[model samples]
Target: MSLLQTAPTCDPDDQWCVWVSELTGNDWLAQAADWLIAKPLALLVLLIIAFVARWLLHRMIDRVTNRAAEGLPTPMLKHKPGKDVPATVLSGRRVQRAQTMGSLLKSIASIVVFTITGITALAQLGFAVGPLIASAGIVGIALGFGAQSLVTDFLSGIFMIVEDQYGVGDAVDLGEAVGTVEAVGLRVTRLRDVEGTVWYVRNGEIIRVGNQSQNWARTVVDVPVSHEQDLFRVQSVLKDVAHEVWEDEDFRSVILEEPEVWGVQDMTPDWITVRVTLKTAPLEQWGVAREMRERIKARFDHLGIELARPARVLIHRDNRAAGEDLETTGAPDGSGTPASS
Candidate 1:
């Protein structure tokens, strides 16, 4: 103030001094200086808040996962011989589903928290956020219209996880592909089919899911025998095979109940099919069916029980000789005797 009072007024012709006087008298410069000094500190605080919120969000998700897991039954399976089976634990599918859900929650929380933090930080820097928020809303609405399929996929994925429709390691038949689920994400599910081809299926496109590894499964073994074989004998043999498989120590745990022999399911001209049904643990039906088939085949072979085989017919014709005889015998007259060559 003292220097300002002692200084002489600048001449209108002196451009440099006039410019300096205007710059020093401007109030906006000081405001800008204060803003510059405070912006970084505000931004740092916002970053800290975002990180803390992220940590809290993850912790909450972990707690929820643990509580959900607690309500589930401990999964157990027969271990290989001579190997120690671990204590009871959650099923592979359950654990994977929990983990996937936790990751999705964390990701969504981070997105929302960071977005809000960014908007707040922008407002602190003296930027108008109302227009930005309005613009974002309009853009979101436009995107919703343009990306309906994307929204459907995300919603379907969310419901799929929440309802526990299918999870990793579960075998499912999605109208287009039948395979084991390898990964389930927000947009798509990855499956590996029997041929080992990995398939990426959009969640919205899966209208129906046939989960084969849930609860229990039925092992159906169809044994076809020749029509010549007695139906009663075949039924008896199949019953014996089923009983043996059920009683076997190696497969005992997989078999939930005694196997049933549904006698004479179908009869064709050449064969009669007998059905053997076994109730087995989830995912064990295939192995049980295969083992039952092998055992039945061996038993049939040992007992000389004939399986249905394709019938072949042979036809013999002497067209050339018959034509020659007809030509020699025809002479515009009826003749009962054969013509001499």
Candidate 2:
């Protein structure tokens, strides 16, 4: 009976309105029912899409993570002198790093997927998506400003792990904290110093990193001998001692290369320093240097090599002769006042 069959409150192609309008007619009731039914259906679809997308993204992430983990390099720990490179397996540090990366990616993907779904649901329910998004952006900005340091720390840690700048068992000098890394995390790096004091350092605060445990290390021992001793002779003796240390069965395992005497490193009136150096395994420099010094000392004792010693000369007047008492007013105290000797 009515030429205007389309509901004014609903879209022309809205299927929900058309389906329910067959019984209720194209009236307010149809539109009301369409809203009640259509909005929920749209929200349901969005949720399904969100879940599917999240699943796909997570699966992709897992695949990529596994690949990365399997192909991970072993730069953080050097290859042993006489051993081949170990295979990358889901164990030890490589697995730990892969797990960290995968978890972070999954979390980000979930947040993004769910957030988009929520916004779409709100828009479907007749809420202004623009203002909602703008308000969310403002709130996000506020939160970012408030938690800048936390964000920086997290980002820094991620990069540190990815780039293999440092890791557990690495002796690192991270600005104020210089020690062996005990644990690495997203926000803080734990270290234990030579004194065994544990340090929790925020990753964001580290500027430059000095990793002393990666690759190989060098041991330098400066042996000072009397300047009067022949420099060439001391250098030969130091070279011999260094070679003995490097060849010793106990020290040879830590020493990577043959030792060398680097001639004189410094010269003073009292002594000349002979620099002996050895290439050693990571973290083995200290022990190797100590051993080199001990061997050099024992060798010097056997060879009667004179070590440098501080010297000072003091002169006194030898006045025990009869003519020495002929002085009239020589001050024995050395004061300006005249006095009898």
TM-score of each: 0.74, 0.64
lDDT of 1 at 247: 95
Error of 2 at 33 (Å): 10
**Model 2 steric clash pairs:** none
| Alpha-carbon runs more than 4 Å astray in model 1 | 1-38, 72-90, 319-341
**Candidate 2's residue-wise lDDT over 168-225, tens digit each?**
8879998898999998888999999999999999999999999986656789888878
What is candidate 1's lDDT per residue for 99-136, written digit by digit as tens? 77777788889899999999999897668999999999
